[model samples]
Target: MNLDELDAALRREFTGAEAERRVVVRQAGDLADTEKAETDRGVPLTVDEIVDNLSDAPDEGVASRWNWWMGALEAAYGGYEPFQVRRIPKE
Candidate 1:
């Protein structure tokens, strides 16, 4: 599905508090990598990697649960094509 539709689904499935928490978890992971790269500068993590990390974050609400559900839907409808809800680059 399109980004707007995915966003709407997230909102409909998640409570406001849960959404905020998810954002915090994702941002924290991204920021951690940025901090690490400041010193090493060897391999800056890609946006896709950061988003993939977030997908593994502990489920906090229906929004997170729906993420898995959407994956299943996409797999069935899109012929097993990967569906990433977060706006991250694809390799």
Candidate 2:
């Protein structure tokens, strides 16, 4: 889907902190962590899933990239995956 469609989907699917977190993170490369976002379009996981992966990931850099949990989300997610929500819009 295009950026607008993705935004609508995100808006419909999430709100508040959850939605905000998705907006902050910038994904790139591949979502090797989870299948939530795996599809013809790209990763489809929610903000919660992303945060979980980040927390579980062996690397800490992923969580250190941004002012995580600033507002939209309230937890950590691994460094942005290429197929992540934030990255898809730019594509």
Candidate 3:
């Protein structure tokens, strides 16, 4: 699913607490590239810094957001492809 669809699904399927946590996790995952860039530059990154960077990043395209959400979901749930998703609880 695309990012907008995924966001809507998360809102629908998750309670307030779970939705908040999902946002945190997704934001963290989104910072992966920025974190790598910082590491390459020999700069240390605090959690807040990473989070802020992620928050400021562009989310203009459905395709980019889809990839981001898929990667985050895969890392959290252990696979990107739906067929590879085990008997985990839907989130």
C-alpha TM-score for every candidate? 0.26, 0.28, 0.28
Error of 2 at 83 (Å): 5.3
lDDT to native, each model: 0.42, 0.37, 0.41
Candidate 1 lDDT score at position 47: 40
State residue 42's C-alpha deviation in candidate 3, in Å.
Answer: 2.2
Give the poorly placed runs of model 3, Cα more than 4 Å off.
Answer: 1-38, 59-89
Going through the candidates in order, what is the number of backbone clashes in each? Answer: 0, 12, 0
Best candidate, lDDT-wise?
Answer: 1
lDDT of 1 by residue, 22-78 (tens): 443353344344454324335444443334443564665533543554455355554
Error of 2 at 22 (Å): 10
Ranking by lDDT: 1, 3, 2
Better of 1 and 2 by lDDT: 1
Q: Which ten residues in a row have the lowest lDDT in candidate 2?
A: 65-74
Give the CA lDDT, 0 to 100, for residue 10 in model 1. Answer: 44
lDDT of 3 by residue, 12-67 (tens): 43334444545534543454434543454365544444333334435533233334
